[model samples]
Target: MNPWEVASPCTQRCVTRPTGNEQAYARTRRVPAASVLRRYASLTAALGSALAAGTRIADPSVLQRHARCVLGALGIGLDATGPLRVPGTAAGTLIVANHVSWLDVIAVLAVEPVPLIAKQEVSGWPVVGPLTRRTGNRFINRDAPRELPRFVGELAAHLRDGGSVMVFPQATTWCTAPGGPFRRAMFEAALRAAAPVRPAAIDYARDGTRSTAAAYVGGDSLAASLLRVAGTDGLAVRVRPCRTLWPHGHDRRSLAAAAHAAVSDAVSAPVLAPRTGVFRTARPPEATVPPQLRAHA
Candidate 1:
């Protein structure tokens, strides 16, 4: 029960204006031929180890540990400032992080083992796709907005069962230096399930300077990003754990704002844009509060 941790529930609010920055792009300088060769060999071996662990192991924790080792082998280092424990009540824990690049997923997974909420298309990616499913992730269809309610219901149920779910509230990827506003729809699920939102900030650096070599943004192909990342020297991913927030008395919008603020502050990124008062989906009647949280609500 740390006083600083902030956690989650859902809201029905949507963004009318686009709140993401399109100008930011991944930039990487050329490295020495020897450096690239060493990293390429390391990355190849890491990928093989990850695939073997994922296919051979059935335990989630074991698979995640192997995944973490793979990230280390690929030169992504973990720099959690404090104990990485996520705090919460009997209700489930919702772990939220800023979405910078595809590497953010691997970085978080390396730090903690939890089920992830990802887009349906990730399930079809070559080697990574099947591994994601085997690791116990839930996939949502980005094409069908109407099915969001169903997905929300499932998320709430997972929380009620005292499980932890990891999500990227930004809803899309941004450059390593910039981040988008947190979408509030997913907050409503936390509201219903009475889950705590754990905000985590992830950043990539090369030789101690912030680097965009890992950003997989606008029109950046997977192969291109991979090549740049593997060739970069002194590249590392840092995961900073922030305080957790609860959704007991607050509505979905306030909760989303709190979580977003925690992450924005942690990463030292400016608040890009506002997404308030935009009506997207009609809100359903307030869900019946559980007895444990009724007093706080």
Candidate 2:
């Protein structure tokens, strides 16, 4: 494993007092200690237990918590809440959401207690990819369609074994509400795997009409986006309830359409406020490695 380097580009020293913008930053500001410590602890233990644990790594919730803490320490925070709650369990499931920023993964994983499905390229990036793989994440090579089947098959077994997967249906990070058409690939994977699809809406807001939400979008890099928000006084994230969709035994195309509609409808809600303080449900399964998730059928 490579040494973990600082990935987020936040530069703001945690401000004690707020001047409008900083208030929003404070609202989301929460330290990234325990999550980070917990993960390292798990890694040390994993080294001793890797052989017994097989090729897959050990518990990664700590890494996710560490990530959230790191982002929080850097003045980045996410508040995800909804009247309609999505139950999280170790039970096999699939999650789909709109892509807002690369931070979307961090914010979601910080609060969401499950592994993720990211793009193939992320697995080869600098520090981020290493961290991603350490957490037992998988990806689809948009360029290599042939390998997708094997990946989908692996995801299927994961669902069958009661694991959960999260996917960004938008495929690319864009800032507009009702963004581009939801890609059909992962939707099909979930259908074939018989995993439920959960749609989450992610948004950014700043003081007044200053528009902090738009900073993370466009062709900007994730590091650049984080630095921009941290340097600013007030930037906030409001995540909507992830809309969970049952396959309904539908075809891939039909399921894709339904999934897209579900996500699109959820994003239609008025802008939401940020959620805080380790939002969690009780007894979320702490899946470390493949376990029974690597099924063949």
Candidate 3:
């Protein structure tokens, strides 16, 4: 196994089943193919420029601007709400959010640029890989459960040194809002470092209505997802940060549950219902860890 591979409980089955092909087709309003091509071209240029600039630009504000520029090139608007920064006296904060699509990374960066804990495969993805590494994000190998403890320890140390981190506790992407349960492993690091946990919610919408056109679940390829996003008109991502949870008296499990509930509540609010049939009611199976691995995690 590759040393950097990460494990995830989510699979193709976790994807929400659409009512039917025709119904799903009628709901989305896609732009012309030429428009999609133009968007992709703009995105490519933006990424290239970012790569050329690379690590030379270490300022968070500059990085945030670049992220917003990338989103603009892709024709995706960002609406971030609530407190986006850590309190003045906080040593560091651990930001956790539900995973929906690959774009979640860029959207979060646009609001608050921070080091991310990403899966190893992300490091090999075209221009994005090189750019993310240059930004000093950490990658993990989920395949090696034994290394989890060391990784968590290092993360705690980083927090202790007053460095904030962003992580997707869902581990894998889901089709839409209220995705999957938060994993407890990363929460352990926050507890060890005495950092606050901030839960954020991310969802995509077309015009003013909720839309799943940007979901990257099932057997969907990155190229296919990117094209879908580019072809969609009036697409926007809404990011809402919930109240922070202190770790003074919380365990990893409790902290994880609290964060998950906060995010779920934030996203579960009533939005304009889709014109199509109802979303799937089934939930994905919970992730399981062995007793020995659980101790380290």
Best candidate per TM-score, number? 3
Give the runs in model 1 whose Cα sits over 4 Å from its true position: 1-29, 54-58, 81-85, 269-297
Model 2, residue 155: distance off in Å is: 1.5
| Residues 22-95 of candidate 3: C-alpha lDDT, one tens digit per residue | 33222457899999989989998888778888685457877777888888888887766634545543457799
Task: Sort all candidates by lDDT, best to worst.
Answer: 3, 1, 2
Between prediction 1 and prediction 2, the one with superior lDDT is: 1
Q: All candidates' TM-scores?
A: 0.77, 0.67, 0.83
The residue-by-residue lDDT of candidate 2 on 69-126, one tens digit each, is 6555544445565322234433466776676566677666665656788777888886
Residue-pair clashes, model 2: 10
- For candidate 3, the lDDT comes to 0.75
lDDT tens string, model 1, 83-129? Answer: 23343256767888887778888777766777899989999998778
Clashes of 1: 25
Task: Specify the poorest-scoring 10-residue window by lDDT in model 3.
Answer: 276-285
lDDT of 3 at 28: 56
lDDT of 2: 0.55
